[model samples]
Target: METLETTKLDLTGKIDVVENISREDFLEFYMKPQKPVIIKHLYGKDAQVYKWTFDYFQKELGELEVGVFDDESETRQDDRSYKKAPMTMKFGEYLQIIQEKPTSKRLFLFNVFKHKKELLNHFKFPNIADNVLSFLPFAFFGGQGAETRIHRDMDNSCVFLTEIAGYKRVVLFDPKYSKLLYQYPYSTHTSIDVNHPDFDKYPGLAHVQGIDCTIGPGDTIFMPSGWWHHIEYNTAGLGFAIRSLSPHYKDRVVGILQVGLKTHIDDLANKILGSKWFDWKKNKTIERANRAIQKLQKK
Candidate 1:
């Protein structure tokens, strides 16, 4: 495996500041570049909501109505794996649900935008409030020792993931590393094991540089679109995320096509060809990528 150094950029650094910038300044200076920035105190100054922790979530909203789905409901392996894991009842569930047991795996998707408007109002910042429509906030509660598969966001949106409670290990790689990462066909990411990578099986990954960051409460990580990121929650924790599209014309066009057409294509392809089609597409894409790599190496 090719080893690359991981760079750590502090959230408090000047590169990440966006405290009082105007909307035009933000779009021109920061949002356009797709560069990752950590805004310190961007949420607020002396905001008591910052003090809100996982325990508080469990206490205040844990008992709210929840919906559950398990292995039997979804045919996808991702769904099965999550169902097999143990999970507890999530607090204030607005969407879907599936539970297995405690301490295994569980997820609570609190539609904070719909259900907890009061909580959101508490942390509203004037600068962001003016542009609040540009962002969406949701809280995730994962049971201890839960893992989210390595995947990119929909429409290749840029993400700002803020840790509210507990700790999480994040692994990030640039889009150029896609081949080395053994990414899925037509997908933005791979299934390469982060803790125990097999370099010989996937030799191309050696060219990629990955940055590892462990986040705690009040810490935010900015991940650009097309960046491959994998997150693992060490303990039960809550995360707030905002996903936004770039102002770039190309990105906007691609985003619209992805949401409007590509999603339907995926669904149709899956239904018509079944798993065989998925396998064929995946392997063919990998083969093409590998061939491209070989050509590059010849230079």
Candidate 2:
């Protein structure tokens, strides 16, 4: 087994403001800086539905038809109703639920905001009108074990992830860490095991500085666009996220380039070089980076 070494993040004394701020102020300070902020009070605080706990979420949302993946069959089944709903289970029970056979056929929630108006209203940010709130809300139901390979959001859109129930663990890296992440062809991340990384292969990762945060119910994390993040559920968690493109013209242009030029490059690389090519390029990049670092150290 590969031993993993991680630098612990100290968010102690970090600012926590729950007050409502104007749209202009939020965009200028918090959103631009990509700083994480938590607001305890919500807009529909008085709504009965908004008061529903994690247990209630499973009871109501879990019964509905959801999307499921069957790993053995390598197929996706849509709008499948769950039989044994495990919403009230503890963290341990949730882990067991994911480990069930077939590894697929796991019913996962989708577009939850359309079903839960009250919960969606609670996330309403300023300057975003009811009809004009241009985003979707989706939730993953199951253990925190499912891995969403490390990747940055498309178009460098800043993202806000608000947790409603349970806990989520996030590992975030700044834009400068992009090269070290060894983004895959036609995708945004490498196949590196983030928990137990291969330092001998990707030594450049040692120079990357990152911020880690574990969020709980009612906590919101603001991640800037283009910032690479890897998220895992520490427990069965329910949450929705909102993403917005940068308002600046220069940022928007770069975002377009990523989607167009970068994406095209990746597609071509995958077609010509095949899957193994990515691994080969990643190794070469790491080797070059190590040599550069050694030279700098001697200087």
Q: Quick one: best lDDT, which candidate?
A: 1
**Candidate 2: worst-modelled 10 consecutive residues by lDDT:** 75-84
Off by over 4 Å in 2: 1-25, 42-65, 69-109, 114-123, 128-133, 268-273, 279-299
- Model 1 global lDDT (CA atoms, 0 to 1): 0.58
lDDT of 1 at 135: 39
What TM-score does candidate 1 get on C-alpha atoms?
Answer: 0.75
TM-score of each: 0.75, 0.68
What CA RMSD would candidate 2 show?
A: 7.4
Q: 51-80 in candidate 1: lDDT tens per residue?
A: 876555556766765443332334444211
Task: Give the C-alpha miss distance for residue 99 in model 2, angstroms.
Answer: 12
lDDT of 2 by residue, 159-194 (tens): 667666667777777766566555543345555556
Give the best candidate by TM-score.
1
